[model samples]
Target chain A: MFNAIQHYRLVQRNRNRAGLGSWHFEWIYKFFLHTGTSRRKYLVEVRQYDEHLYTVDFYAKVHNVNRYRLRTHQHAAGKLGATVLAIIARTIQQDPQACFGFIAAAMLTETTDENTRRFQLYTRMLELKINPARYKVEAFAENSTIFVLPHGLVSQPDALQNTITRYDQIFREVF
Target chain B: MTKYSAKSSKKADPRQQAREERKARNRAIAPERIAKVHIMADGRKLLELKPVQIPGYTYAF
Candidate 1:
């Protein structure tokens, strides 16, 4: 069932090089989603906050003549969601103890309602794809932020809660 | 019962009512302020970064 969701290949770039200086991301992954007619470019950045905590940020763009522009086309929403899920799965596999926090910001839309819609879309995707046994998912719908913590940490409730609190505070400050 | 009285007796669908309430609740929650960094120079710099080439690589999901 998971493989049924079509996604483009994610290409890793600059493993050792520094990421965006201002953001301090450790790694950047790039992928192009082919929508039958045109291909959209996407960049996924992973920023490590602590030993096992990280945040993922991604955006899509289209090459317009010479420069790239933000792609606002909504037709590829399914593929976009699938690609992000694949990235998260890959990240967790690489580091079993890794906890991820991210925001479903309405980058393309202007209205607050669109932000809510985007948050709902991301929450739904996470619910459908992420396994409940291995990970504990907590979402702040009002803030459009989500944290996925490893279920192994449930044995240490204090540590888990602290991590969530720290990440929430960081998200509020950084984003 | 009279036609007007019978029409007035009809109740709203519980599922539909719940959905409307959910929508209102969602709308009431203010969205977080998202930084417009993508349109800025930092975002473009990411696009400028050169992509590494891999031999015999094929696109897969």
Candidate 2:
């Protein structure tokens, strides 16, 4: 918890150093409740500590594949899954009263591997089959908004800020 | 019953066969190496110079 606070501070510092004035940062704390049921729905309690710090209920593991590479849902091939769809589903099921919602992901990469190619095929297939928007199926490049701070830069405010600024540019392009 | 040889097969087209073979080969070729570049908050560029070889899938189920 203390480490998360320090990391949040570094992120704020990084954001300020980059002069990304339009972008806003907030720190929040979230607690998860386990409702004993078959449904995966859980209660998330969000507490806003300050303007730039916050906590999340969960963190998805960083994809090992390159940042520039797009991934699709290929279970055995290790491609990107239908993750955004799942997130939307969970959000709908989550307790309605929660204040802040957060999602974190690692940086994108350039190289494409066998898994990535497989995932791409799946994405294209889905695009043809149905309205992907209904399921929140967007391209990985377009979907990247959060760049989970790399460990080395967690303390380096300037570096983290610059990286995030770059991501902001990327998100802007897709948007 | 042997189902393999019992079914009647249609004549295959030479052009279609060639196209399928080419498509398979293209799919097998690895994509070009593209580095993951990052700009530090200080405006310095950081490239992932060393690619760590992960042994297995990062998740289960």
Candidate 3:
């Protein structure tokens, strides 16, 4: 579990590299009633938005479906907000709560256009192996950065970067 | 809900056992050998110095 800075940096860098102007992103915390006929589950929704930002819940940067997110969040909520919501998702499991194995974050596409982003997500689906494939990239456009979320994301490039390096020190001390 | 600590201690401590870990180190020890080194420019203390031999260097005995 590293700092969220690197994640922000990469997202910013990717935006710059993709020539999307000086982009800005903030982490949001939201929950959802993830139900599919046979299975009923809760999911954590994370995303980043731009321009005239306002507090919202169940907001959709995509089409039709707007997820249930927390409204009126503190500006500093950041990645921590995303993580707490993920924990909620893990706990709601009936048979196996927190039993999805390793921690991972769903890369909700850093590129533009839903179709193209979905294709990118599909082509590089291996990176999303650890993250839940529930939400399609174009389906939801939030911060496309990494969080020490309760899913599978252990790649070098797909990692969250932070200004602080205490995680290593913490690992050394704890492990 | 046991705990993250409980699951960890089962295989920690020993690995985190703090030893005199060489943080940063380098060695310099001159060995007995005939080599050209700095001589006294005063010409009074000019003497043949030996070559420096570092530790862990293999030598034909």
Candidate 4:
């Protein structure tokens, strides 16, 4: 049931070195999804925290006739989920030992109930797409922050827990 | 012989209790704060950088 959604082709945009601000991101990628008459543009940002830890953040905007507007839902959620999974897969491929953390942003949601639904949707997507054997998925339900840790660190439970604690602390302090 | 109290007589549904607890926790976190990190076309220039405050997470231009 989960495999039905097909992801769009992701294109990496060249970074402008001069305009690069203080927040140095490892890379950025974008993809276009054509649904019906409107085209949705999704931008993904990857920020490396340490040698093997990175965070992925992405948002989507609908390309209206003249201007771009942020649209969270386009009736193509499954496709978007698949595309995000593809992005995570690509990132892990680049660095096999890389750990990832991301927050399920509740952008433009009408109410708190809708926000919770969005968070649950992201949690379900990760459960379906990520392999438990290869990576450990830990979700902080209160804030919708999720961490995908490498399975290799499972042997040392203290290290794994400490890593998650440290990363969560850093995420809160910075963002 | 005494009658049972209305509050103590009825048992709470565990699932319902759990659901309410989850909702309360979710309510504590504001939606806007959840996605505070905005990524713009210029790559996060919109954010006010306080690299000195956060140790070991400094950004390099």
RMSD of each: 13.2, 17.8, 25.5, 13.5
Worst 10 residues of 1 chain A by lDDT: A62-71
Q: TM-scores of all models?
A: 0.61, 0.23, 0.16, 0.60
Summarize candidate 4's per-residue lDDT along A1-175 as a digit string, tens digits: 2343344454554443554433334577777767788776787777665547777777775354312124544677767777667777777777888887776655443333232555666655665566655665555654566666665764465666666666666577546
In order of TM-score, best first, we have: 1, 4, 2, 3
Candidate 2 per-residue lDDT over residues A1-175, each given as its tens digit = 0011111111121232444433433222222222233212122222222222222332222353432232322221211123322332233344322112222233245242323443434333333322222221222222222222224453455655544555445334323
DockQ of each: 0.03, 0.05, 0.01, 0.03
The residue ranges of model 4 lying beyond 4 angstroms of the native Cα positions read: A1-25, A62-70, A107-115, B1-61
Model 3 in CAPRI terms: which quality?
A: incorrect
Clashing pairs in 4: none
Better of 3 and 4 by TM-score: 4
Question: How well is each residue in A92-167 modelled by candidate 3, as lDDT tens digits?
Answer: 3321212111112232332333223322232222122223322111111122211122222222212312201222
CAPRI accuracy category, model 4: incorrect
If both were scored by lDDT, which would come out higher, candidate 2 or candidate 4?
Answer: 4
Model 1 CA deviation exceeding 4 Å by range: A1-25, A62-71, A107-115, A154-156, B1-22, B25-61
Better of 1 and 3 by TM-score: 1
The list of candidate 3 runs beyond 4 A from truth reads A1-81, A97-175, B1-61
Query: Tens digits of per-residue lDDT for model 3 on B1-61?
Result: 4798678668545434443232111111122321222222222211122222345432111
Instruction: After the best TM-score superposition of candidate 4, give how far the Cα of residue A16 lies from its true spot, in angstroms.
Output: 11
